[model samples]
Target: MRIVADTGRCVGAGQCVLTAPDIFDQDEDEGTVVLRTAQVSGDALERVRQAVHICPSQALSLCED
Candidate 1:
């Protein structure tokens, strides 16, 4: 799977970062959701899915690649 982050839709809620620090992070300057990587699998995929669902601004999503 692949992660897709809509940075413009992010509100700096930090939910994604908290949910999956390995896959997501907050930019220091903007505090927006910064994707650590686009591809995900194994244990990381689960956390990424949770992050996408919990993102307050609906800024995160996943797609099959």
Candidate 2:
């Protein structure tokens, strides 16, 4: 799976980071979503999906490739 982060739509709620710190982070200045990795697999896939679901701004999505 591939992570799609729309930083422009991010409100920086930090839910993504809180849910999956290994895959997501927040920009210190803008508080936007910063993706640590665009590709996801294994255990991290579920966490990333949870993060996407919890994102207040709907800035995160996963695409199966």
Candidate 3:
């Protein structure tokens, strides 16, 4: 699975970063969600899922393709 982030929809909540810092980060300027990497490892999927669910703006998703 891969992580997908829509920065335009982000509210700079930082929930993604808190849940999965290894895969998600915040842009320094705007503090919006930023993808550290789109590729998600098996072990990191759990954390990514939590991040997606907890995100206030719902800007993150998983792409199975």
Per-residue lDDT over 6-26 for candidate 1, one digit per residue giving the tens place of the 0 to 100 score = 989999999998888988888
Query: Which is the better candidate, 1 or 2, if ranked by lDDT?
Result: 2
lDDT of 3 by residue, 1-65 (tens): 98889999999999888888888888999999888899887889999999989988889999897
Candidate 3 segments whose C-alpha is farther than 4 A from its true place: none
> Which is the leading candidate under lDDT?
2
Q: At residue 58, give the lDDT of candidate 2.
A: 94
Residue 57 lDDT in model 1? 91
The TM-score of predicted model 1 comes to 0.95
Against the true structure, candidate 2 reaches a TM-score of: 0.95
Please list the Cα RMSD from the true structure of every candidate, rounded to 1 decimal place.
0.7, 0.6, 0.8
* lDDT, model 1, position 53: 86
Ten residues in a row with the worst lDDT in model 2?
Answer: 22-31
Task: State TM-scores per candidate.
Answer: 0.95, 0.95, 0.94
lDDT of each: 0.90, 0.92, 0.89
Top candidate on TM-score is: 2
